[model samples]
Target: MPPLPSHEYHVGIICALHIEMAAMRAMLDEEHGTFSKKAIHDHNTYFGGQIHNHNVVIACLPAGIDGVVAAGTVAKDMSRTFEQLRFGLLVGTGAGIPNLEAGVDVRLGDVVVSRPSGVYGGVVQYYRGKSKAGGMWEPKGMLNAPPVVLLTALQSLQAEYELEDSRMPSYLAKMLERRPKMRSMGYARPEMDKDVLYLAAYHHVVGRTTCDACEVAQTLARPPRVSTDPQIHYGVIASGDRVVNDAVTRDRLRQDYGALCVEMEAAGLMNDFPCLVIRGICGYADSHKNENWRRYGAATAAAYAKELLLHASIEETSQEKPVQQILGKSSETTRSEQDWAEQFFSKKQVTFQ
Candidate 1:
């Protein structure tokens, strides 16, 4: 076993779900020929590749793993092996906040980027708080904002989008051409006519396969967005361990913390590493959830992430020390990431020529 060729990874993309990981992998321009060795004590796996001239790495969480502790563990290990990592991205899908007010008509499949607005940081942990009786809860701590380079890129991208529609669709189409699984109907974008915005009080029928059990008469009507492109919304994003599937709770959290989206893994990475969260809106944060649009949502987020990397000019920062200096050992001497994958599940290993 040997350490990688003293090279630094320009960026790392972290995803909690396989669908999201596949989307990120699809954007790789060239996969590294060598397989990465997993850190001795960690269970996470890593894939090496290049995207837009920068060496990039993508890491996926283990099965049934979706929370702060799990995401933080992967982020820490990734830093040790990929010492040259300047910044990271929590790229995945999240539930969208369906508030049609103040000129923000965020819809399903839209991209939500975490950005510091007012009192809240870009990412907020909804469960990191002291709960009291009478439904009173106080937030505990603040999460770290994204690195300066990434933030600058986001600002520039936002300015560009304001002038024109998002370019995610084209990028997504190209990526899908390479990775057909992502374009399957299960992961593919569903029809816009199927996009439903039910009333807050309307509850999804239990043990039903489709939304037919619920009354369409109770749906909410709102003006169609001027642009059908996946709009980008910048603001706080609520993260917690629990899956928020209730509209009442989702709206309350959005209003209380000014969260534009609700997700699960960003809280883990933000405190430990300086990274940005880019979430593709899969569905409304309500009970009528399904996987019809998950694939497309994840692809949109991944495409946006790649676009952001194009704006990042690698900074020669002094803070980055090699893994040998930080972890006291060569990462290559450890078990291979493929070995870890074999122990749990059987998925085809992504290889480079």
Candidate 2:
């Protein structure tokens, strides 16, 4: 792979699925230019375009692949190609960790922004620990907090939203209008009335796509929210190697770890990349999982990402001397991720285990 043109693209956004990637790509205000470059090591393509005043590049996994390991490989290759990358944004859809019983009523189509509170960082990987047949477990290591710059920007955005209101809904509306394909029922916003919360033990009927087959009498009664607009929750995000479809496990994890959202990719990126994780809540992390609100959830997260970028400045993100310049290397393929591991994480070893 040849070197990218010596232009500074300060931001890199990564998504796990095509829908998530499309949601973000649709929000580029003025795509002044577009280009694709393959990673020298993995051959994964990184798409580049201009969004607002920033040069942004996005990388996504090939179809049908999902998990932390794949995310790490794509992010690694993306870093190699976009040498001027300052920080990355893992923007995508995830499962909500809502326990109406606990007053944490995160519904479908809401957005969750990982923010550090107490000992937990912005994101935590629940699958990192060891398990035994007796239900015994050993805790795994914790991931570092997101870069200070991202945390600062998140605080600013939160304060601004508190004073007024979120612009995510309007941004999503315009995005759907611009990209009409996202206006379909599956991708378009779902009716707030259809958002249901079923009993954890009452699983969805097998081979059914809709919830009509599930016993409506088993639903959990909760006070309706005043706003249907996507509400943003800030706190720890639970990430693991597998999808959380079991409500029993989801609630157990939520009760145990206080996770606001559940996802599959952010854990891997935590090792070498100091970036923020923003996820839209599409499903309830239960047996009744469906694509009904996934597209809308992804759109909301992408819109929030764009809103956050408006507050970011290149000066803070580019404080570190350019790694490419420091190494005096034209292409990053000459150095492996092991080289970066030494620089980023130091003597501490990082692995998917």
Best by TM-score: 2
Give the clashing pairs for model 2.
none
Q: What TM-scores do the predictions have?
A: 0.85, 0.86
lDDT of each structure? 0.74, 0.75
Model 1 ranges with Cα > 4 A deviation: 1-6, 131-136, 315-353
**Residues 1-353, candidate 2, lDDT per residue (tens digit)?**
23236356778899998888888888887553444544466567666665667778887887887777787777776777777777789999999988676678898888899899777788876655555455543336677787777888898888899797888877888987887777864667788768888888888888988887888899888787787788888998987666667787777677657888989889878756667999988888788856778888888899999989876766776784432343321211213433432332222222221
Model 2 ranges with Cα > 4 A deviation: 1-6, 32-34, 131-138, 320-353
Give the lDDT of residue 113 in candidate 1: 94
Please, what are the lDDT tens digits per residue for candidate 1 over residues 59-95?
A: 8888887777688778887776666677788999998
| Clashes per candidate (backbone, < 3 Å) | 0, 0
Worst-scoring 10-residue span by lDDT in model 2: 344-353
Q: Give candidate 1's TM-score.
A: 0.85
